[model samples]
Target chain A: MHVPVLKQGDYLIASVQSVLSDADLVQLRDDLAERVGQFRSRGVIIDVTVLDVIDSFATRTLRAVAHMLKLRGAETVIVGIQPDVAFAMVQLGLTLEGVGTALDLEEGLAYLDRLARKPVKHGK
Target chain B: MENNEACVSINSAADIVTARQKGRALALELGFDGSDLTLIATAISEVARNIVNHAKSGEIVVSPMNHSNKRGILVVARDEGPGIKDIAKAMQYGYSTNKGLGVGLPGAKWLMDEFDIESKVGKGTTVTMKKWLH
Candidate 1:
């Protein structure tokens, strides 16, 4: 299952197109982290609408992805978690806490845009 | 018995995906709804992952069943690897010796209607879970 990461302006969009295995999830994390620097991306949007189940492994790997992007001075937003998947995640105690999430691709882009419009933190 | 059963071997992380996908497909054919299908699929993923992570290899078996006219899906994950030293500790939430969230087993239990596990030190482990079509 390949997750295609597309570069859009200063943001990156990685849309999951199929059921991803553990190896695939790790590959995605590394791929995005590398692209964030190679492309000098400011934000990332991961579309998971195609995913039917996001279990513990997937959740942890995604958290790692977001954390890695943040360390590289890039923000990450996960979008398109189905309602049933969300309910299962909640029951499994797999809340994507500390990670930004939006309803879909449009909201994710809007969120990133709003963050970009704000003044840079600190005195920089 | 014609099309009510399926089995997938769990070896690598890739097998986890296969097992869960097959589980979801079987569950759907068994008349499980949207959320229930997701729940069953997630539960299978967790158990199958355990087989790969700890046992190195195993298998997941899923089948449709009936409990007094109440249809349900049964999932059984079996592996012959280093058994859990403390099943209780392993089942507890947030308890993990491996580099994981430690919620795989417990979370899987929460997602299913019925859950059971058996293990022996230095022997192996088997996890059986069920989800009713509700």
Candidate 2:
């Protein structure tokens, strides 16, 4: 499935629409990471609400994508993980560790806006 | 589609989707819904992916089962690739011989109600798993 990545202000939003194959997930990661740099996006929101099964491969790939975007100086927040998909992911020992998550597109945009408002912190 | 069993040949990533799609259809038909159906489909994805990543080729057979009291879905993945030499070690987390997170096997095991693996070096491997409707 092709995931549409749209730019809003300084952030990118990728809304996944259907079941994704392994290759599709990998392609999305590469595409998002590349676009983050090209568009100079400040944050990215990946919406996976339509995905019913977030399995091991998908989980691992998404985690990697988040990290990749982080290194590109873009904050990543995964939004719209369904309740059922979340439960199944947990049951399969998959967790989106170290990745930011929000409820929906609006909340995700709000999160990015809040980050934009906060003063950039120095080394922790 | 009305049949109780479905066999999907696996080679590429698309086959994985097909198998899991078939699995989801069967699970839904068996009256499993919500997270339970997702669990089954996810388990199938993990196993089917293993076939694509490690075995290079395999087939997954999904069917419905009825015990004396409970009913569930059964999934079996078989491959004639380089089989695992150490089943126990392969089951451990963070142990991978390829470019994967090494969680597929154990994760699939965790999702299903029952899981079994049979393998022989230089021969083949078979993974059987089930998730019951509760």
Top DockQ model: 1
Q: Which residue pairs collide in model 1, if any?
A: none
Tens digit of per-residue lDDT, candidate 1, span B1-134: 54568899888988888898899999888888899999999999999999988999989999888778798889999999999999999999999888899999999999999999999988899999998877
Candidate 1 docking class = high
DockQ (Cα-based) per candidate?
A: 0.89, 0.76
> Per-residue lDDT of A23-121 in model 2, one digit per residue for the tens?
889889999989988988889999998998888888999999999999998888999999988888877777899998999989988888876453455
Give model 2's DockQ, 2 decimals.
Answer: 0.76
Cα RMSD for candidates in order? 2.8, 3.6
- List ranges where model 2 is wrong by over 4 Å: A117-124, B1-3
TM-score of chain A of 2: 0.91
Taking all chains together, each candidate's TM-score versus the true structure is: 0.95, 0.94
